[model samples]
Target chain A: MSGTLNEARLMALYHNPSAASELDRAIAQDPAAAALVAEWRRQDAALGALYGPVGQEPVPARLRDIILQAETPANLPRSPWQIAAAAGILITFGASLGFGGSVLVARSGASPSLVADALRAHETYVVEVRHPVEVAGSDAQHLQAWLNKRVGMSFTPPILTDYGYNLLGGRIVPVDQGAAALLMYENAEGARITLYIAAEPGQGETAFRFDQEDGVQSVWWIDGGLGCAVTGDLPREALRAIGTEAYDQILPAET
Target chain B: MAVLDEIEAAIPALRRYAIALLRDRDAADDLVQDALERAVRRRADLRGEGKVLSWLFAILLNLVRDRHRHLTRSAHLVPIEAAADQGLPPAQDGSLALTEVHAAMGRLPLDQRAVLLLVALEGRSLAEAARALGVTEGTAASRLGRARAALRVATGRDRQTGTGGES
Candidate 1:
């Protein structure tokens, strides 16, 4: 059917409705307008046919690797404000059980201290020129073995397949008494979440905690002699949920 | 689970778009690479899950614009090549027909090109196109109209075989 300039324009607006009637009428009056609109429809359909099936293409392996590689090290230093607050808490109660519980509660309330470690990690290491991460996720087996050895805890990498974050790998570094383990997971969208597992300071009491600082969120808990912290740039609630999920999956299995 | 799979699924389309826009296979791959890298790194920047495709497109679009401008300014302007390079596979018989459409698309203004790509190629509604391009609905509609008209004129199909004069 011949569609008119005005009718076709209207048809474009309502992509196949009452405008069909208008299009038919316009075509009866003017064939050229009808041809023009028909061509547009044809071209639109043709282009759609040419490029429309793109969603089915497999995600490139190289791009996937690059995204998986974007995991920054979890060594961001605390901000001055966070440092001050942490110092205040450390000095005020000195790791007494009552003081530690109160401190965790107070830090959770503050929001700035909860994710202090995570944000610090993101800011510091994400921009590193040569050494963003000590261990690349590419060495999954080696990193895992090393990390497990470092923390003195035997833990399987959290199965993040359900969360759209895959375990890239892990690394080790010195902590309070011995060493800490940093396991990294990556989502397809290039977001990296780090799981920091270490031995808690013997002097400190066990606590379940969540915190946010400078937009990063972290949740930590001490279970079965190993203290674990999960950190990411996600919202406090999301980080907490992931943290809780990790805690539930890993902590119980180990204990 | 599904969200990651879907995003993983979108990478090919994203790669194709990048290649089309940059016309260099390596550069196109790099664009997709940077886009994916940023996306994974900034996944938490996305508030919720399941909007991964949209978010990836947004990231890809930004990266393409930046790289396009930088490369265009750095290198002297030249007419886009008439055909895909010899090394790349020949346009399949079907896409050969759409080559004219791609050429017409290349000739249109950038603003119009963005709208048409979002609408015709990406299957986005005009409103969605507008949102993606960060333009108003009216502007998107106007650009789309102009794009359609330009394509009609360039293809020598502005008038029917029997029609007398231009409208």
Candidate 2:
């Protein structure tokens, strides 16, 4: 019932002859249609002839190993952000572990774990003289302004004078659900503190948590739905004290 | 357990598809390796038990397309003859079918080439080819048409038929 097969339909039928019954009927009715069918069949057969059977080739053992390795938990390399989040998880749990609430559900609470994660993140990257913060504290005005805009509040760099910490700078870190702000500070003695801030965690979580991992101590809390964590090598008491002061200054309405 | 075993069994099929698509044993191996690596990495992402071959085929096609784009940009056409040594038989002067077929395939554009291999070589259905190529069934059919036509032209069969079916 056709003069010329539509290129598109011809293409479809060419790949799957079983579905081309109408075309086959048209071919049976017309000589030209019959020849087109025959020619197309030869082309298909020729294409099939191009490559010999491929089933015998060996799947390289190394390739199989690589794929299988990816399945194992240990093979999953923790990104810096994941590591930081883990620390935050610990900070949340650690605080809850100390304070004793929701003892059954380990890492479910929001503010505590989030704060904990940030503090842990701070501990990770604050000490490096190079790349301490994304935008250096040398440009304090710009750094503060940029972070203030991004973190959705006016930010005055928290002063650590009483704690012997001076502002270093800050950077941006991406988390699973949202963004994080990282602030770095260094003491005259070259000790460093990192502040990581993000949104609160799951419901019924701690307001404060202190944790230590890999020689770094972090204190984390939630204020106004924002999770904040302070990380350092300082004693847990000192870190907690620093966290409390920073939280008070950051969370309280500015006079 | 059955799904994993099925996929494990399909590895040989995947490698075969990849080999035909890439035309080089080592490169085909590399492509299969990357696909399997991804499959293992995101095992939780597997949709169902029986779709392993389709999944692997999709991954292999993506790799092939990516490499083809990269190679095309580099304009490197390392002839099939140069790459087809070792496993291939020495030209016995008779039965030029294999050589002609290889040359014909090497001349197809990537889309057409993928369709021909999936439908003709791998014996995948039009629907399966469409899924592997990430195209609609109509698009797959059209590509298959052009692929077969191109092969006919490349193999000199189109010339023997006279100018009646010529386009």
TM-score of chain B of each: 0.73, 0.80
Candidate 2 CAPRI category: acceptable
Q: Please state the Cα-based DockQ of model 1 relative to the true two-chain complex.
A: 0.25
| After superposition, candidate 1 runs with Cα above 4 Å error | A1-36, A48-59, A67-255, B1-3, B48-50, B70-97, B160-167
The clash number for model 1 is 14
**Which tens-of-lDDT digit does each residue in A28-107 have in candidate 2?**
76665566666665555544444545676544555544433332232242578656754776566467445433332254
Reference-based lDDT, residue A192, model 2: 81
- Candidate 2 regions exceeding 4 Å error are A1-4, A17-26, A64-255, B73-76, B82-96, B160-167
| lDDT, residue B72, model 2 | 37
What proportion of the true contacts does each candidate reproduce? 0.38, 0.58
Clashes in model 2: which pairs? A11-B141, A88-A116, A88-A117, A92-A112, A92-A113, A110-A201, A110-A202
Candidate DockQ values, in order, are: 0.25, 0.26
> Candidate 2: lDDT of B157?
57
For the second chain of model 2, what is the TM-score against the true structure's chain B? 0.80
